[model samples]
Target: MSDAVPLLPFVRRDRAMRWAVGIGAGWLAAFVVLLVIAQIHPSTAIVDLPYLVPIVVAVGLSFAAAWKTSGRTRIAWVLFAVSNLLWLIGEVIWVFYTYVFQRGPPAVSVADFFYLSSYVLAVPAILVAIGSSGHLRHIRGLLDAGLLALGVGTIGWQVAIAPSLPHAPRLADAVAFAYPLFGVATVTLLAAVGLAGRHRLPAWAGLVGAGFAVAGVTDAVYAYTIAKQNIDSNWINIGWQVEAVLLGLGAVAAIRRPEPETRQRDRVRDLTAVPLVIAAMSAAGLILADRLDGGPITGGTLAILLALFAGVLARQLLIIRDRTRLATQLRAALREQERLAITDGLTGVYNRRFFQEMLRIEAERADRADSPLSVILLDLDEFKKVNDGYGHPAGDTVLAQIADRIRGSVRAADIVARYGGEEFGCLLPGVDEEVAIEIAEQIRQSIGRLEVAVGQGRSVKLTSSLGVATAGTRGGHSLDDPDGLVNEADSALYRAKATGRNRVVAAGMLVDPVYADPDLPIGLVWLADRIDAQISVHEHSTAVSRWSLLVAERLGLDMAALRRVGAAGRLHDIGKVMVADSVLRKALPLTAREWEDLRRHPDESARLLTELGGRPDLAAVAAAHHEWFDGTGYPRGLAGAQIPIEARVIAVTDAWAAMLADRPFAPTLTVDEARVEIERGRGTQFDPAVADAFLALVTAGMIGALAEPARA
Candidate 1:
C-alpha cells in the first residue's frame, strides 16, 4: 500500500542533497584545522579561544536556515538557532572565567545551566524534524522506538548515573545525571529513524538524526568525566562544535526542499531488527555489570530490566492481534470469491454451467438410490415484446421477478438456475412426471399473476410455458444420458409453445400429430422443433398455421390441400437454421449480401421436405412462399398464374402474421394496421385472390381477434 501523495510536485531532491554535501565538506575541513591547532598547544587559552570562531559560524548558518523555511521545518530550525546561541553563551562564560579571572569556573555555575538547557531543547527539536516528514507516524514505529529507549535507558542508568552518585557534589549530582538521561532519549530516536528505511525518507532528516546521535554520545562522555572529577582539555568540547555544524547543515538542506516521496509498507515485518538487537544487548549489559562488580543485581538495575521485558511482551501481543485480524479477513474474501465464480452476476442465480454440472451429479445420485429425477424448463412467452415495448431494463426486472416466483413455488431441494436468456431450469430429484407437471403449473400461475414494475409506475403482466421430463418414465436414449434428458425436456417445451403458449407439456405424453410422429429422423425432428420453438415462442407459427388454413379454405381449397398448406406454413422456415442467428435476429436492415444469403432458405426448405419427408406437394409450397404476384420475388420469380395457390395463400397470411408479431426490425402492428398493410400489398407482394380471402376473414370477425394488443 503506497502512501497518498499530494498532486503538486516538490522541489527536486537531488539539488537539496548536493547543497547539504557542500556545506558538510566545509564543516569537516574547519574541524580538521581546529583539531591540528589544539594538538600543538594543549595547555594554552589560545587553543580554546579560537573555538568561538566555529561556534559563531554554526550560529550564523542556523539563523540563516531558520529565516528561509516554514511550518514544522521553520520551528525546528528556530529551535536549533536558539540551542546553538545557548552553547555559544556557555563557551563565552567558560572563556571569561578561565582567561580573565585565571581560574576554572565553580561547580554548577551559570555555564552549566545554559549547557543543560540546550541539551533539553535539542531532543524535541530532533523529534520535530523527524516528524516533519509524514512517514514516521505509525504506531508500531513509536512502540519499536519505545522498546529501544527502554533497553538503552536501563543500561545507561546502571552504568553512568549509579557510579556518579558516590562522590559528585549534591548541587551538581542531579545536573550531572540529567544529561545522560537526555542522551539516552536522543539515541533511541536516532536509532528508530535510521532503522526505518533511510532512502525512503527526506535527505535532511537523516543528517539531523546523525547530528543528534553524535551529540548524545558526547553528552554521555561529559557526564561520566564530571562524575569522576576528570574534567580537562580533551575531545569532548570538540564534539559540541561538530554537533553544531551538522545541525547547521541539516537546517540549510531543509530550507527549500520538500518532503520526499514515500512508499508505505502495510506489514510490520517490513521493519528492521534493530529493536531485537538492542533488547539482547541490554540483557547482556546487566549480566556483564553484575559480573564486573562481583555482586547480585541492584534494585535500580533489576527494575529497569523488568521494564524492558514488559515492553517486549507488549510488542509481541500487538503482533499476534494483527495476524488474527488479517486471517479472518482473508477467509471471508475467499468465500465471497468462490460464491461469485458459480453465480450469475445479474440475477444472483446459479448459471447454466453450474446447472449442467448439478444435473449430472443429481442423475448419478438418483441412479444409486433407484429414485426418479425430473427437470422442468420454463420459457417466458413473448418475452421480447416486453423489451420492445418498455426497454431492456424493464425486461430484466420481469425476469428477476419471475425467477423469485419460481423459487417460491418449488421445494427447497429443487435447484433453480437461469439456463439462458429468458429461460430458467429447475432440478427436482425424487419427483415423478405427474408431480413435476403439477409443480410446473404452480410456478406458471405464480408468474402469470405477478405485475412486475417496469418504470414510471407502469407494470406488465406475463405468462410462462413449461415442459417437464422425468427419468425412467419412457426409457430410451434419454434415460442413458443427462444431455438426452434435457433435450427431451426441451422438445416438450417446443410442443408447449407450438400448441399455443402458457401451458405445461410433459415429455412422452405430447399428442400433437406433427411432433408425435416417430417416422421423422431424430436429427431432423430436433431441428424442426428448434425452428418452431424460435418462431412461435411468441405464437408466431401457431398464428400462421391457423390463418393459412382459414385463407386456404376461403380460396376454395379441398380438405386434403388445406391440411398440406397448414403444415407447409408451419415448416416453411425450418431451413432458416442454416442462416446465422446474427442475420436473422439483427435489429437493422439486411445488406445486399445478407439478403442474398437469406433468400436461399426457401429453396433449402423445399429440398429438405422433398428429400427427407418424401412429400413434393409440401416442398413445392415451401419453395414458392416468397414469390410475389408481380415478377420481383427471389429464386425464379413466378408472377400471376405461375405461382402455386397454396404458396400465394401462405405468403399473404405469413406477411400478416409477421406484422402482428413483435419483431426486431419492425414494431408490432394493431389489427386495423395489419389489415391496411395487407390491402396495400394486394397485387405486388401478395397474391390478389389470397389477399382478398385474408381481408374477407378479417372483415367477417373470424381471425382478427388473434392479434389483440398485449395486456399492460
Candidate 2:
C-alpha cells in the first residue's frame, strides 16, 4: 500500500539525471544573460519565454526522480514531485497573463491558487519524511527541534515582515504578510528536522530542503518590493531562476540510491551556540534601529525578546537533565556486561575462567586455616552418542539438566562451574575425603535419575562419572598447587571411564583388577619400561596423534587413512627400545656408527609391529616415515608420491614435534625456528603438500599450545 518504488534500471537513471542537471545549469546561465540585456533594452518577449525553461525542466526531473525512489522514503519524493508540478502550472498562468493577455500580474488570480497549494503540500511532505526516519521518537530530540525552530522563526519575523505591512492594499497586504510568515515556517521546519535526525540528513533530501528555503526568501523579498510599487528588479527574477536550478539538482541527486546508515558522531552539535548568538544579535539590532528612528521600543518587540531569552534557558535545562539520565543508564549497562562475561551464556552457570579463579582462592583459604579442601570433576558418559543419535540441541538439553542436578546435589557453600564441553568442576571447602566421595556419589546418582525430553515425544536417560580429590590427603601436593588437584581428579575420572562408567572414583583408590597375559614378550615389556622412563612419552604421542590427524584432514584423506596416520604417529619411536640406553641418552652429536644405529630403529619398529600381528599398515607407515620426498633417504629411496600419503603426513608431524621438544643431543627450538626448519626441508626431507598443510595449521594458531615442549 506504500507509494515506494524501487530505484532500479541504474544505467538509465544515471544518464537521465545527468542530462537534467546539465540542461538546468545551461538554462540558469541563459537567464543571467537575459537579465543583463534587459538592463539596456527594457522588456522583451525573448526574456519572457526563456524564463519558463528552468521551471519546466525542474518539474520534469522531480517527477522522474520520484518514479525511481524506493522504500518508505518514496512517499516524500512523490509529494515533492506534485509540488513542483503545481509551481510549473502557476508559472504558466503568470506568463499567460503578462505576455498573452497584455496585462500586469493580478493580485488574487488563478496563479495564486496553484502557488499557494504547493506550499501547503510541501509542509506535510517534510513532516512525513522526518516521522518516517524515527528520529523524533526521542523526547530530547523533539524538544531540541522545537526550541531551534522557535528561535529561528522569531529572528525571521523581526527582520523581514513587520515593516512592509503598514502601507499596502487589503488584498496585497494580506499576500505580502503571508509570504514572510510561510518563509519563516518553512525554513524553521527544515532546520529543525535536520537537527532532530542527529544532523545526518540524506544528501538529496538536504539539497531539497535548502532549495525550499532559498525559494521562500526570494518570494518574501519580491512580495515586499512589489507592495511598494517597485516591480522591475532583475535581481529578484534571477533569484527565482536560481531556485529552480537548485531544485533540479536536488531531484537528480534523489534518483541515486543512498548507502545503509551508520552511527557516526556528529560535530555539528558543538556549534549550538551559533544559533543562540544569532537570536541575540537580531534582538539587539531591532532595539538599536528603533532608537535611530527617534521612536521608543514597542511592547511587541520587548515581548519577542523576552520569549527568546526564555527559550534559551529551557534548552540548557533539557541538556543538563538528559546528560544526567544518560550517565546513570551507562553505569547500569556496564554492570550487566561484567556479569555476562563471568557467566556461561547457554547453561546460566559460572564458566571455566571464573571456576579456576575460585579454585585458587579456596585453596589459599584452606592453606591458611589448615583445613581440607576438595574438588570433584564430573563428565557425562557417551555424550558424543547422545549428540549423534538425537541432535546437538538434545545434547545441549542434557548438559543443562546435568548442570542443574549437580547444582542441587552440592551444599550451599560449594561452587559449581561448567569447565569445558560436558565437563563440570565443583569446589568443596572444609570437607574431608569421605564426605567429598559421598557428595560425588550423590551427584552421580542424581544425574543418573534425569530423563530429558528431546522433542518428537522421545526422552533420553543420562548418567555421569565423577572423580573426587582432597587436598592434604594424597601426599599434600595439592595444597601447594591448585592445578595439581585438578590433574589428580582428572586421572581418577579416567580410571572410572576405563573401568565401568556411571560411578565415583576417589584419588588413590585401587583400579579394578583384570587378567595379565603370561605369554607377553620380554622385549615388549622392556619397550614399555623405556616408554615409562621418558616422563611425557604418552603426552608427546597424544600431541603427535592430534597433529597428524589434522594434517591428514587438510590433505583430504579418508577416515581409514586418518586412523593409519594417528597409529604411526603414536608408535613412530617404538624401535628405540632395541638401542642401548647409553647411546639414546648420549647428550652430544653422534658418530657415523651411532647415527646408523639410530637410523635402523624405524625398520626395526616395522618388523616388531609386523610380528605383533594385525598392524601391518601401521608398520608400513612407521617404516616409510624416514623415506625422503627426493629419493635420498635411508632404509628406502622412495620419491614423490611413491611413498604412502599417511607416512608422508607422519614425517612432517614427527619432525615438527621433535624440533620443538627437548632431547639429550639438542635443545628445543623456538616456534619461529621450528617453522623455518620445516619449510627448509620441503620437497627434500618432507612431502611439499604435507609441509604446507602443517605450516598452514601453525599460521592459524591451531598448534601453538601443542607446540610446548613436553615436561620431564
Candidate 3:
C-alpha cells in the first residue's frame, strides 16, 4: 500500500486526460451531424446558438490555463481567452438576428468586426508564445512563414477572389477581400511558430495553432461563397465547431504542462528543402491552373512567383553568411589551443617540451651549416628562500621578473624557455662559445641588479647562476651532440653553484679528455660521485669493483678486461639514483613494485655510459650484470654466453658484496655462510665458470673479507 501511494497522482492525471479526449471526440461527432443536418434540411431551426456552448466552454478553459501559468505563457493564454470570448460575442449576435428577427445578418455586420478583431489579437498571442527563441531564429522564422503564406495566398487568389470580383458590392467586396488577408496573416503567424527551430512546440501550442488556422481558412472560404451568392452550403460550419473543440483541448493541455524555469531556446535549422518544396508546389499549382483554364499569364500570379524567387535568394545568402562566421571562429579557436599547448602558463615563455624539440632542430641546422650552436642553462640561486620567506606569490613575482631580465639580456634570435622549476634554458644557433659566455654573464649581472616587490614596502633581491656550452671541439675532438651540449652546460651550472651563489661558468673551462685510459670520463665520474654522495652506495660499489677484478683475473682475463669488469661493477647500480631513498633504505623486504623500480637501474646505467662516455662496450657490461645464467632475470633475459663476459664476471662479485653487506633488506652473512650460498647457486644464479673462479680466489685468501674494511 505504501509503495502504490506515490503513483496515485499520476494515475488520476491519466484518467482526467482520457475523459477530456473522449468528450472532445464526442462533441466533434455531434457538431459534424449538425453540419450535415443543416445542409440536408434547408430551413432547419438550428443556428449559431447551439455553437455558443462550445465557445463558452473554450473561454473558461483558456482563462483556467492562464491562471495556472506565469510569464509570457500566461499572457498568451489570457489572449486566447479574450479572443475566444470575442468570437463567442459575435456568435451570440448572429444567433439573435437569425432567431429573433427570423432572418440572416447583413453581409458585413458588427459580428464580422468582432471576428476580425479576435484574429488580430491572435497574431500577437502566437508571437509572444513562440518568439522567445532568440532574435536571429525568430527573424528567420518570419521569413520562412512569409514565403509559405505567399504560396497559399496566391492559390486563394487564383481560385476564389478572381472569379467573383465584378458581381459583389464595394463594401461587401472589401469585406470579402479582408477575410483572405486576415487568413494569410493568421496562417503566417502559425507557420512561423511551427517552423521556427528544431525544437517541437508543446502539445498545447500545436492544438492552438491548428484551431486558429482551421477557423481562418474556413472564414476565407465563407467569403468566397458569399461573393458567389451561394449560402446553401453552410456545411463549412463544421470548421467553426472543430475550432471550438480544439481550442478548448489546447487550453486543457496548457494547464496540464508544467512551466519550465527558463524557456527552451533552439538553434536555427539548416532546412533548405522546406523553401524549395513550397516554391515548387506554388509554381506547379499555377501551371496546372493555367493549363485547365487555357488563360494567359496574369499580373497577380507573376508577382507572387517573383517574390518567391527573391525570398529563396535572401535565405541562401543568410546561410552563406552564417557559415562563414562560424568558419572564422573555428580557426581562431584552433590557433588559441595551439598557443596554449606550447607555452608555459606562469612565465609566458616556451615550455620544456618545445625547448627540447627546438634543441634538436637547431642542432640539425648547425650540422648542415657547419656553424656553432650554444646552450645556456640558468638556475636561480636560493629561490626556495624567496618562497619560504615572502610566500609563493612573491616567489612567482621574482621568477617572472627574472625571466623578463633573461629575455632582455639574450639575442633576438635565441629561444628562451623554462626548463623546470627555477631553471631556464636559452638555445642559441650560429653562435660560438665566446658569444654564449658573454650572453650568460650579461644575464647573471642583470638578474643580480633586479629587485622584485613582495608586498607593502618590502622587496627581495635576486641572483642567478648560469652555465654556457657551445657545440664544438672539446679536448681536440668534435663534441656536437645536442644532449652533450645541454649536459655540459648543466655540469658547468653545478660548478657555478658550488663555487659561489651567483656566477657564470663555461664548459670549455672545465674540459676533460674525451677518452680516459683507466679512469671514468669526467661526466661519468661526476655522475658516480653524485650517486655515492646522495645515497651512500660507495662502500658497496668500491668493494664490488675490487672483487670483480680479482674474479676476472682468476678466470685468466687480461688487464683491459679486468678494468672493464671493475668499472661495470662500480657503475651497474648507478641508475639506482632515480629510485627513492626511502625504498633503498627500507628496513623491511621491498614490495614487488619497489623491486621492479629497483631493477630498472641496469638499463639506465647502460644508457648513461653510452651517452655520456660514448662507450657502448661499457654500457653492454653494465646493462646485463643482473641476467641469470638460466634466463630468469629482469630487463633482458640473456642466458649463458649471451651475457657479456664482463657483466657475467661482475654479477658474481656484485652478489658477493651484497650478501656480506649489512643491507636493509638482507641479513649480513659471515664468510663461510656467504661461501656456501655462492657455491649452492654456482650453475643456476651465477655462471659456473665465474663462480668457480670467485670461490677459488676466496679459498686461496687472495681476496679479503667481502665487506669494506672497518675504519680504525
Q: What are the root-mean-square deviations of the candidates from the true structure over C-alphas?
A: 15.0, 21.6, 20.8
Per-candidate TM-score against the hidden true structure: 0.51, 0.57, 0.50
Give lDDT per model, in order: 0.72, 0.70, 0.74
* Sort by lDDT, top down from the best: 3, 1, 2
Q: Write the per-residue lDDT of candidate 1 for residues 32-122, one digit (tens) a residue.
A: 6766776785654545666677678777877887787766667777887888788789888988888888887887789988877776666
Greater-lDDT candidate between 1 and 3: 3
Which residue pairs show collisions in model 2? Answer: none
Candidate number with greatest TM-score: 2
Better of 1 and 2 by lDDT: 1
> What is candidate 3's lDDT per residue for 397-416, written digit by digit as tens?
87888889989988788899
Better of 2 and 3 by lDDT: 3
Error of 2 at 71 (Å): 3.8
- State residue 545's C-alpha deviation in candidate 3, in Å: 38
Poorest stretch of ten by lDDT in candidate 1:
3-12
Tens digit per residue, CA lDDT, model 2, 390-428: 889988988888888999988889989898899999999
